[model samples]
Target: MSVARTLFRLTLLAGALSPGLAHAAGLDGSQLSLLWALPFAGLLLSIALFPIVAPEVWHHHFGKISLGWALAFLLPCALWLDPATAGGVVVHAMVDEYLPFIVLLFALYTISGGILITGNLHGSPVLNTGLLALGAACASLMGTTGAAMLLIRPLLRANDNRRHNVHVVVFFIFLVGNIGGGLTPIGDPPLFLGFLKGVSFAWTFSNMLLPVLTACLILLVVFYLLDSHYYRKEGVLPRDPTPDNARLGIQGVFNFALLAGVVGAVLMSGMWQPGLDLNVLGVKVGIQNLLRDGILLTLAGASLALTPTTLRDANEFNWGPIAEVGKLFAAIFITMAPAIAILRAGPQGDLAALVALVSSADGSPINPMYFWLTGSLSSFLDNAPTYLVFFNLASGDATQMMTEYSATLLAISAGAVFMGANSYIGNAPNFMIKAIAEQRGVPMPGFFGYMGWAWVFLFPLFVLLTLVFFR
Candidate 1:
C-alpha cells in the first residue's frame, strides 16, 4: 500500500481503538492535577529552546517534535479517560478550533503570495520611516503577515546599500509585524480568534484605535529618530541599486480584491449566523463557519489558478511557514486543552493560583495584570492560544467582555497583539520576517538579542499604554 494510504489506515485504526479502551468518562479540570500540564510545558520549551540549541534538527523535524508532544497528551488521555471522551476531545479540537485557524492562515498565505511589489526606492531616513508607517497602516487592511511579506523585500532592497540597517528591520517588526496588527481582527491571529469566539468585527478597531495609534506613532517616531542618527553617522549616502529611472509599481494587483473577499467572508460568518450547525464528534460546526472556510479555500484556489505563477515566484512565496504553523498549532491546540480547561475551571482548578493572580483580593479584575500576564506569556508562547486562555480567565462570554468587562477585553487584545513584538517567537510573522531578512543578508539579532531590543523599546511603551489605557 502507498504510504499515504497506510498512514490514513493507521489513523482510522487508532481512532477506532481509542473508544474501546475508555477508562473514565471525561476530564474534569478541577479534579485533575497539575501533572496534566506537562505536555504543554514540554511543547512550549521545545518551541523556545530547540531552534536555538539545535537549529538543524529543529529545521528538519520540529513537526515531529510537536506531534510527539501531542501524543504525550493524547495517549495518556486515551488510556485514562473514557474512549468516547478522549476521541471526542481530539475530534472537537481538530474540527472546531484547529481547522478554521489553519485554513484562514492558508488562505491568507496563498492569496498574499500572489501579490508582488517589484521596484525599490532609496531608503532615506524619511523614506524608510514612511514605508514603515505605510506598512503599519496597511497591516490592519491586509494583515501583518501580508504587509510584512509584501513590503519587506522592497524595504530591504531600498536599504541594501546602507551600512547600519539592522535597526530598520527591527523597527519593521516592531511596527508592522506586531503592533500594527492591533487595530483589526483580520490584522492578527489572536484578534481573529477573538472574532471567531464572537467578538464583533468592528469591536477591535473601535476599542483598539487609540492604543494601536499611540503605540505605532511612538514606535515610528523612535524609528525615524534612530534611522536619522544612523543616516548622519554614515558620512556619505550609498548609491541607489535600482536605476534612478526605474519606476515603482505593484505586479499582481488583482489579489487585492481576493484579499477583500477573504475579509468579507470572515465578516459574513460573524454577522450572518443562520442558527444552523452540524454536530460532529460532539462539536457544533456552524454552517456560517463552514461556508466561510469554503469561501476562503475557493479564494485561495482562485489566486493560485488565476494569478501568474511567475508573480508568486517573484514574491518568493512558499508553503513552509504556513505548514510549520499548521503542524505546531495542531499540537498546541490539543495539548493546551487541559490547560484551557483548568483555566476555565477558575478558582477550583489546580491552576487556581495562576488564575487568581489576575484578580485582586476584592475579586475585582485587575486590568493591568491582565495586560502584562497575557502579553508576557504571549511573548513566549503562541499569542493566539494565550489570548484564548486569558479570555476565558477574564470571563468567557463575548458579550459580557464587550460590555461589562470591556477594559479587560481591550487589555487582553492589546497585550496579545502589541506585545507579540517582544520576541521573535511572539507572532508568526516576526520570525519569518527575521528569516527573510537574514536570507537577504541582513544581520538580524539572535533570540535573546532581539528581546533586549524589545525590552529597551517596547516595554516602556507598554507601560505607558497600561498607565493611560489599561489602568
Candidate 2:
C-alpha cells in the first residue's frame, strides 16, 4: 500500500502560525508552471534510455544520475521556493512515501526469498500459464507485491531451461504485477486509498469483477498461445538445471507468517487511527504509520535473521534490485511531487486544460476520458495518488461515487489498476520482476521495448474495454 491517507493532510495549525511557511510547505499547483515537470521527465527518460545507450554507465552510476535529477528539482525549490519548503518536501518524500513503500517491498522480497518451492516442474506452456493464473489469484489476497515476490523465483526456476521464455516473464508482469490487483482494496495501493476515503471494502471486488476477469482471460489466452509457439520453436530445451526430481514441497514455512505480518501492518496503518500525530519538523507523521513501518522493518530483519542463509542462497536472494529501485524511485517520488500537485490542483492548475477534458462544460464526468486520462497518468505517475486525484475529481463522496457515479468510479479503478501494465514504472512490481528476470539471465526488454510489448498486446483490449464498459 502507499502512504496512509492522513500523510497528505499535514497539520495546518503549524502552517497557520506561519503563513509564508505554510505556502512554501504545501506547493500550490495552480501557481506552478508546466516547466516544473522537466526534472521528472528527465529522470524518467534517463531510466528508460540509459540502460540501452550505456549499460555499463547505468549499472555503475544510476544512483548518482537519479540524485542529480532529484537535485534539479530540489535546488530550485530551495533557492526560489524556500528552504523550509524544500526541506519539508524532501522529508515528506522520504518519510511519507518512499520509506513505507520500500519497507513493504523489502519485507516481501526478503520473506518470499526464504520460501523455497522445491521441485523440478517443467516450464511447459500449460504449466507456466497455470503459474501465472495462480499468482494472479493470490494477488488480490496478499497484494501485487506479495504475490509477485512469492511466486517469481519459482516461475523463473521452472523456466530456467527454456531459451525463449522472456515472453513468459513479460506476461507474468502483465497479469500478476498489474491486472491481478484490480479486484480488492488490499490488492493495490489505489483501492486501499479508496477504502481509506470511505469506499466500502467489498466495492472494488464487486464492481471490478468483470473488468478484472476480462483482462485476466485475454492476457492468459494470448500468453498461452504465444508460449506454446515458443515451446514448439525452441524444442529440445537445454538440460534442466534443477532436475533433482525430489518431491515438490514448500520450505521455510515460517516466512509465510512474516508475510501475514506484513499484510497486517499495512491494514492496521490504514484502518486503525490513534489520532496522535508525531510532529517531525512541520509535517505531522501519524503514529500508527510509524508503528506500521517499525513492524515492517522488524519483520524484514526477523526474516533475515531467522530464515537460514542457505535458503536465501538457494533462492538467489540479492538486494541489488531493491536498492536500485529505492534510489531511482526516491528521485521519482520527489521530482514528480510538483506534477502530482498540479493534478491535485484540479481546474485551477497550469494543467487546467488537460483536467478540463475529464468533464464537459456542464461538469458531467466523461467516462471514457476518465479511464484513458487516469490510465495515461497512472502509467507514468504513482497509480495510488493518481487514483486519489480522480477520486476527488469525480466526487470524493463514497456514497455518491459508489452509486449514481459508479460507472466513473469503475473507469478510474480499471485505469489505475489495468493500465499499470503499460510501463515498468507504472507500478513498483513491474520493474522488480524485470530486474530479477534479467539477473537470472533472461533477456528482458529495455523500458521502451517493454512498452512495445504492451502496445502490441494490451491496446486492443483497452479499446474493447472502453467500448463495452466505459461507453
Candidate 3:
C-alpha cells in the first residue's frame, strides 16, 4: 500500500477504536502500565533480529513492519486514552521531531554524496591510519554520514589489495562513523536533536572535546598498531591497483561550499531566533527552524543541480539508507511516545525504577550510570532517541542542563556519541560504512561477530572513560 493510504487507514482505525474517553491534555504516564511498551519492544526486536534472520523480507517490507508496530501502539492508545490526545502525540512526533531529524540527515546525505574522492593511495599502515584520522577529523565538520560516504570508497580502494583489511573498515566505523561526530551538533543526529531542543551548538564542542579527542586518539593508535602487525604478517605487498604515479584528487568540490551553507544555516537557526513561532497540533515550530530546514533543502538541491552527475555516479549515491532511516525512525518516534512520556513522568511514573538507575541513594545524579545507561542503550537502539530519553530523564530544561547539571549533560552526550562505535547498528553511518565496505569486498563481520570486536577493544576503553571522566 502507499504510505499515504496506510497513514489514512491507521487514522481511521484509531478514530474507530476511540472509546469515548474524556479529552486528556496529554498522556498521564504515571497511570500508564508497562504493557504499553510491548509494541516498542517488538519494534526493537524487529530492528535487531529481522535483517539477520530474513534479509530479503526485511529489505522489502521493513516499512510495513514498522507501520504495523506503530499501529499496535496507536490503536490501543486511542482506545484507552483520548483519540485527540493520541493524534496530537502522532502529530508532535512527526512535525516536531521526526521531520526535522530526517530532513537534516537527507540534506547531509545528498550533499555529501555529490562529492567523490578520486584516485587511490597505497594501504600501508601509516597511510591507512592517516586516512582514518583525516576522515575522523572531517566527520564533525561535515557529519558522520557525509564523511563516511565521502571517504569509505577511497579507503576501501586503498586497502583492496590487502588480505587482512577487515580491521581497517571496523576501525573506520569506530572512528569516522561514530566517535568523531561527537564534537558538534551538526556532527550527528543525536547532538543535532539536542540542538533543536535548545542545547547550544557549541555546547557539544566545548564539553565533548577532551573525551572525543581521547577516544579518537586511542582508537587511531590501536588501529595503526593492529594494521602494522597485519601488514608484516602479509609478507609481500600486493601489486598496486592504481598507477604508482597516480595522485589523489577530489571531484564535485562545489559541494564543499554547499556543506558550509548547511552549517551556516544550522547556526543561523540557533543564533538568529526571532521569537516568532508556529504551533502545529500543540508542538511549537519556530520560524528560524523552518528557515533552517528550507536552507538545508535548498543547499541539497543546489548540490544536485551544480555537481556533475558523473561525480554522484562515481560515489554510488542512492536513496536507500535515508529511506530506511526515515521508515524505521518514523515507527520509532511514534511507538516510543508512551515510553518517552513515561520517562518524563520521572519519580511518579511506571519507569521510576529505571529513572532511579541514573541517580544515587542520596538522590544525586549519578554521572557514570548516566554514561553507561545512555551508552549501552545507544549501542543497540538508535542513539538519537536514546539521548533524548536520558535528556528528558535528567532534566529537559536546556539551560539547566548546560549550567547547573553540566557534568551530567556531558556524561549523557559522551555516552550517546562515543559508545555508538560499539556496534554497527549503534549509529546510521556505521551500517552504511559496513555495507559499502562489504560491497567493495572488504568482508565485514556479521552482527554478533562485530560485537566481539567491540567487546575486546571498545568496552575496556568505555570502562576507563567512566572511571576517569564520568565518575
Candidate 4:
C-alpha cells in the first residue's frame, strides 16, 4: 500500500474509534494552514491512485471517486484530533437517527406513484411533466430514492421509442431522482439531519415550495422543448392512445396497508431518546433502553411483516434498485464520516473571507445565495455532511452585524436541503438513479458530462429561484 492510502485508512480507523478531537484542540495558524492544505493534496493523490487500486473496483466503482475525495481530508483530521470530540462526532453520525424518516419517506414514495397502481395516463402530452410533478411531490414524501425507483423504468419505457433519447434520461435524473427530493425531510437525508437538529419538519415544506415549484416548472418546459426536438429529429410518429392494460391491475391495496404500518412503526421509533429515564419491569431504564431493545426490534418485525409481494407486479419489483442504493449509500455512509468532522471544526480565514463575500452586507443576499451554491456542491459531495457544514456556517449566530436579513435560520436550512439535487452526486439517490440506469443497459454520461447538463438546465432555474424568493 502507498503511504497515502495507509494514512487514509488509519485516519478512518481513528475516527471510528473517536471523532472530531482535532478541531476542538484549537490548532494555531500554521497548524490550521497545514490542515487546509491536506484536502487539496489528498484530492490529487486519490485521483492519481484511483486507476491503480483494482481493475474491477475501478470499472464497477469508479463513480465513487467524488466520495473518495471527501473522506481523504476528513480521515486525517480525525486521526490527529482528540478522542472525545472524534468519538462524539462519529457516534452521532453512526446512530442512524434519520433511519425512521428514511423508512417512512421511502414507504410513501414506493406506495404512491412508485407503485404505479394507477398506471400512466396514456397518450397525454403532459405525460412527462405530470410524472415530473408527481416525482417532485413524491420526493418530499418518499425520498428521492424511493420515487426514482418507482418511476424510472416506466418513464424510460415511455420514451423507449425515441431514437435520440439521451436527454430524457438525463432530465429524469435531474428532476425526479434528485432536485425533487429537496422539499421535505423525507425528500432527502441531509434535510432529515436538519430536522433532527431542531429545524421544524413543517417549516421546510412551506419554505422550499417556491424554489421546488420554480425548478419543476422550468425543467418541465425544458423537457418539453428537448423532447420535442428529439421527437422531431427522429421523425417518430406518435401512437394513438393504446387501450388500458387492466391486467396489470391494482392488486396491492393490502400492500399499501402494510406499507403504512411500516411507516407508523418508524415514526413511533423517533419519539424515544437515548439516555432518558423510563420505568419498566420494576427497574428504571433509560430512553436508550426503549430505543435499542424495544423500538428497534419492533421496527425489524414490522418491516419483515410488511414485505408485500404486490410490488413484484405493481412496480415491476426487482432487487436491482435495492442492491444499487445499498451499495453506493453504504460506501457513502461509511466513508464520509471523517469529512463531516473536519468541516465541523469551522471555517479558516480564507473560507471565512470567501463566506463574507458570498453573504451580502444585507445578510439576505449571502444566505440564500450561499444556500443555492452550497446546495449545488452538496450534490457531488455526500450532501448530508455538506449540508451540516453550511448549516453551521449560515446559522453560525454571527448575523448581528448584517442588515436586511429577515429570514430565520430555518429558511437557510430549507434552502440547503431543497436545492441539493442540482447534480448527480448532490444526493445519494441521484447517483443510485444513474447506477441503476447504467446497470439496466442505458448509456449515460460521465460525471463531468452530467454536470454539463445541470449547468445549462439547473443553473438558470436556480437563478430564477434566487430572483423570486431569496431577493
Candidate 5:
C-alpha cells in the first residue's frame, strides 16, 4: 500500500484504540475523536518517517503541521452543535463574529499604507531603538498593524546598509506587533473582542497603561543594547547624511484623523443599548443592533474612503497579508464552529472549572496568578474565547468589583495578547511578520530559535510585569 494510505489506515486504527479520543461528548465527539486521534497519530508517525521519506516537505511544512494539530485538538470540542444547526451557526460566526475583526485589521492595514519591512540597514542603533519604542507606543493608538506599517519602511531604510540588524525586525515584532497594542481596543483584536463581550470599552485604556509603559521601557533598553552592538560591528552609516527628508513626515494627516474616528467607533461599540427604543422619522429601531453592526461597518467603509492617494502612493498594494489572514480565519471559522457551541452550552460551568484549575482568589478580588496563567493559555487557544471564558468565570457577578477590578482584568487580557508574540504560532501577526520578513530575504530564526530570543530576553520581563503589576 502507498505510504499516505498506510498512514491514514493507522490513524483510523489509533482512533479506534485510544480511549481518550473515544470519550468526547456526543455525535460531534465521536466525529472529533476519529479525526483528532488518527490524523494526529499519523502526523507523529510522519514526523518520525520524514528523514527517510520526505525531509524537504517536512522541513517547509512543519508550521502547517503544528496548526493542523491545534485544529484537530480544538475543533472536536468546539464543534458540538448538531450538523443540522451548524449552517446557521457558521453563518453567524462568519458574518457577526469574525467579520468585524477582519474589517478592523484590513482598515488598519490600508490606512497605514500597507508598508511591510524585511531588510537590514545602517544607522544610529540608539536612534533606531528609539524609533521602535516610539513605533510601539504609537501602535496602541494607531493599531499595532498600522504602527507596524508606518515604521517598517523607515526602519528598513535606516538599517539598509547592514546584515547584522535582524534583531531590529524581531524587536519590532515584539513591540509593534504585540506589546504596543495593549492600551486600547483598536490596538489589538482580542481586546476588541473583549469590548464586544461587555467588558467596558474605556476601561481597557485606563487599566492597561501601566503594563504598556512597562513593556515599552524593557523593549527600548534591550533593543538599544542589541541594536548598538550590531550597528558598531557592521559600521552601517546612513547613506544620505543630509537632514532634509530625514525627519518623520506626516504624509496624510487626514488619514490619521479618520483613524482616530475608527477608534471612537470601536469604543462606542461597548455601550450597552437595549433593543428597540429609538425612532428615526417615527420608525422604531433597535439601538443594540446599530451599535453592534452599524458602527464597525461604518468605520470599515470610512477607512477605505479616508485616503485619497494612499493606495496610489503605496504602489500595487498586494493583499498577500490580508489574503493569508482570510484563509486562516476561514479555517478557524469552520474548525472552531463546534467549539463555541460547546462553550456556550454552559459557559458558566466550564469557566468555573478553568478558573478553579488556574487561579486562587484572595478575599474580594481575584488575584493575579489566575489571571496570568489563564492569559498565558489563552495565547494558545483562541484568545477571544479564552478571554471571554475567564471574563465570564471571574466576573460572574460583575458587580462594582468587576468594574473596579477592570484595570487588573484589562492587564490580564493585555498580557495574553502581548506575550502571544513570544512564539511564532502564539498570535496571527507573529507568523505574518515572520513570513513577510523572510520573503524579503532577512533571515529570521527557526521556531525553536525564535523561542530562545523570547525566553532569554522577553519572558523574564513578562514574569516581572505579572508580579509587579498584575499580581
Candidate 6:
C-alpha cells in the first residue's frame, strides 16, 4: 500500500514536469488582456457582495462559488494558454504559495484559539486602552486573526456593562485587527505574502516600525478620549451582565510558547538558506520554507493534543471561520496569478495605464501614489492581493524593492496594513471581529455603517501618515 501510494505521488510529480513548467513563472502577460482578470474580479465581487446581496445562498454555496471562480480562471488558462503551463501554474500556486500561507494561518488560529482570558476587568478608559495595546502587540506575534479572536471576547465582557460601547469594538477592530499587524509579517496575511516573495522578515519590522507606531499611538489616544467621553456620558455603568470576583487569568498559557515557536519558525525560514530546493512544477520549494511549514503544523498539532478540548470550548472555538477562509482564499490565490503576472509585466502589459498612474515620467515610482492607491483599494478589496498587486507593480524584483524603491515598498506595506482599518471587510479579521461583537450583543454597525465610523476616525490619520511618511 505504501509503495503504491509513493508510486502514485511520484508519477504525479513526474507528469507535472514539462518544458512549459520551466517558464510557468514567466508567463507573458502582454499577450494576456484585462478580460483575463474577470474571474478574479468576479470572485472578489462574490466575496464582497454575495453575503449582503444573498446571505443564505452565499452561506450555503460559497464553496461552490469559490470553485466556480477558480475554474473560471483555470479552465480558460488551460484552453487558451499552453496546457502544460496552465497545469504548472496551478501546481506552483498551490504548492509554492497557498500551502505555506494557509498552514501558518491554520497553526496560529488553532493554537491561539486554545487560549482563553478567564476573567474580565472593568472597561475603564485606561483599562480598555491597555487591552487594545496588548492586542496590538499580540497581533504581531500571533497574527491579527489569532490576536483578535483571543482578546475580543474578553474585551466585550470588560465593556458589556457600559452603555456606549459600539465605539469600543469599532476601535478594537481598528487597532487589533489591522494597524497593529503592520510591524511584522507574522502579523498579517499581506505581509506574510511579502515575506514569501523574498522581502526579508527584518525588513518588514524595520521599515514598518515608524508608520505602525505612529498609527497605533494616535489611535490609542483617540480610543482613550472617545471611551472617556462615553464613560462620562454613561454617568454610572450598567450592572455587569456576567460579573465575577475571580482574579483574571489565562487558560492554555503554553500556547504563548507555541506562538513564539511560530515566530522562530518563520524567521528561521528566511535566514537559514540551505541552498536546496524541491523542484515541484518548476517552482523551487525551499527546504527552509518546507521545514517552517512542517514545524507550524506540528505546533498546531501539539496545541490540539496538549490543550484540553475544554479550553477550546470555553473560548467557543470552532473550525467554521478557518474552513471558510481556507476555501475562499484557495480560489483567490489561484485567480490572482494572472493579476500578479500582469502587474509584473509592467509597462508592457494591459495595466500599462495603471503602471503610469504610480510612476513618474522618468519611470521612477511615485511613493505617495503607491500609498493611496494601495490603501484605497485595500479599503475595499482584500489587502493581501492588493499589496501584491502594488508590490509587483513597483518592481517584481524583491532586492530592488528593498533598496532602490525602499520608500515605495514602505508606502505599499504601510498602506496595506494600516488602511485595512478603513472598512469592515478590508481585512479578514475585521468582519470576524464585527461578527463576534454583534453576537456578543454589541449592536455592531452594518457594512456601510462601519465605513462611516472609519471615515470619521481613520481617514485623517491616513492623511497625516501620507504627509509624514509617503510624502
TM-score for each predicted model, relative to the true structure: 0.87, 0.94, 0.88, 0.70, 0.71, 0.85
Model 4, 280: alpha-carbon shift in Å? 21
How good is model 1 by TM-score?
A: 0.87
Against the reference, the lDDT scores of all candidates come to: 0.82, 0.87, 0.82, 0.54, 0.58, 0.81
Top-TM-score candidate index: 2
Quick one: best lDDT, which candidate?
2
lDDT of 2 by residue, 1-471 (tens): 122222223223233334344334877788899899999999999999999999999998888888888779878987898766766666667666777788888888888888999898889999999999999998998899899989999999999999898899999999999899889888889898898888887888999999999889989999999999999999788899886766699999999999889889988988998899876645578999899989998998998999898988988989988877877888898899999999999889988888899998798999999999999999999998999999999999999999999999999999999999999999999989988998999999999999999999999989999998998
Residue-level lDDT of model 5, residues 292-354, one tens digit each, is: 446555654665566555443532344565655544554454455444434433324333344
lDDT of 4: 0.54
After superposing all C-alphas onto the true structure, candidate 3 shows an RMSD in angstroms of 3.5
On the 0 to 100 scale, the lDDT of residue 316 in model 2 is 92
Model 1 C-alpha lDDT per residue in residues 1-471, reported as the tens digit of each score: 432233234344444554432222345788778788899889878877787899889878888888888778878877776556556556656766778877877887788778876666888999999999999998988889878877887898889899999999999999889899888888988898898788987788899999999998998899989999999999787686677777788878889899889888987887786999875444567899999999999999999999997888866677766766666777777787787667667789987887788999987799998999889878866788789989988889999999999999999999899989998878878867887787678988777778899999998999999999988
| Candidate order by decreasing TM-score | 2, 3, 1, 6, 5, 4
Clashing pairs in 6: none
For 206-251, candidate 4 gives per-residue lDDT tens digits of 7667667777778888888777766667665465232356333454
| Candidate 4: regions farther than 4 A off | 1-93, 96-125, 237-248, 261-321, 330-339, 347-350, 358-365, 396-411
